[model samples]
Target: MKVFGICGYSGSGKTTLLEAMIALLTARGLKVSLIKHAHHGFDIDKPGKDSWRHREAGAGEIALITDKRWVLMHEARNEEPPQLVDILERLSPCDLVLLEGFKRAVHPKIEVHRPSLGKPPVWPEDCDIVAVASDQAIDCALPRLDLNDPEQVADFVLKHVGLK
Candidate 1:
């Protein structure tokens, strides 16, 4: 699958842009998958839940199955967080993969920026940033898109990734 990343500081609207792009991409009949990176410790299984109990009992992985969905949780234990490529290898094929995190990963990316956040764009520093979507004008030489218009950002992404 063609992979692209959406990266930005906290509350800079990365998720917002990604949501709109996902809707637009899906509407275009493109199958899209996403990989999001989280820095904090997280838990999908609740205390007293069956999966939680299994995990507490030393299961390395737990699969919770239901009519609507199935979730697999793998405990990393002493292992460090897996690399982006490792995670990508496990995903089923799709037309495109929209990555919401892994800012440090070297991949083609669209840097989402909200000038109101008072932060500089990631592009000039991160060469992998093929484009910038921002809430304000930037003097960047690379392609730039209005963050308010997701369709424009989506078009830029498709074109940058050669899917256009």
Candidate 2:
């Protein structure tokens, strides 16, 4: 799949921007897949759910399939977290995969920056960041998109990534 990344520090509105973009992207008839990276431990199952119980009971992988959706949860156990490329291999083909993390990966990316975050931009140190979306103007060789304007940002992303 053609891949793009949306990355930024915590509270920098990465998820919000991505959510907005996803709606616009899908409305345009493009099938999109996403892979988000979480630094801390997280669980999707409820405490009393059978799936939770099965996982707690040391099931290696669990597939919870229903009419509307299917979820496959794999327990890493003592194994290292799967690499991005490895996970990508398992995904069915799509028009694009907009990854929310894996900032260090070689794929092209857009860096979301809000100056109020008091954090420096990642593009300076990472060449893979092809553009920046921010609340205020700044001097940079790469393109700067308005973070508050998801439609414009979506347009820029599509153009920058050479996607229709």
lDDT (10s digit) by residue, model 2, range 1-164 = 78899999999998999999999999999888999999899989999899999999999999999999999999999999999999899999988888997888889999998888899889899999989999999877899999999999888778766785
Looking at model 2, residue 95 earns an lDDT score of 83
> Candidate 2: global Cα-lDDT?
0.91
The Cα local distance difference test for each model comes to: 0.89, 0.91
Best by lDDT: 2
Model 2: how far residue 49 lies from native, Å: 1.4
In Å, residue 6's CA in model 1 sits off its true spot by: 0.4
1-164 in candidate 1: lDDT tens per residue?
89999998999888988999999999999999999998888898799988899999999989888999888899998988889999899999998999997888999998888888888777889989888888888888988889899999889889878899
Model 1 CA RMSD to the hidden true structure, in angstroms: 1.0
Give me the runs in candidate 2 sitting further than 4 Å from their true place: none
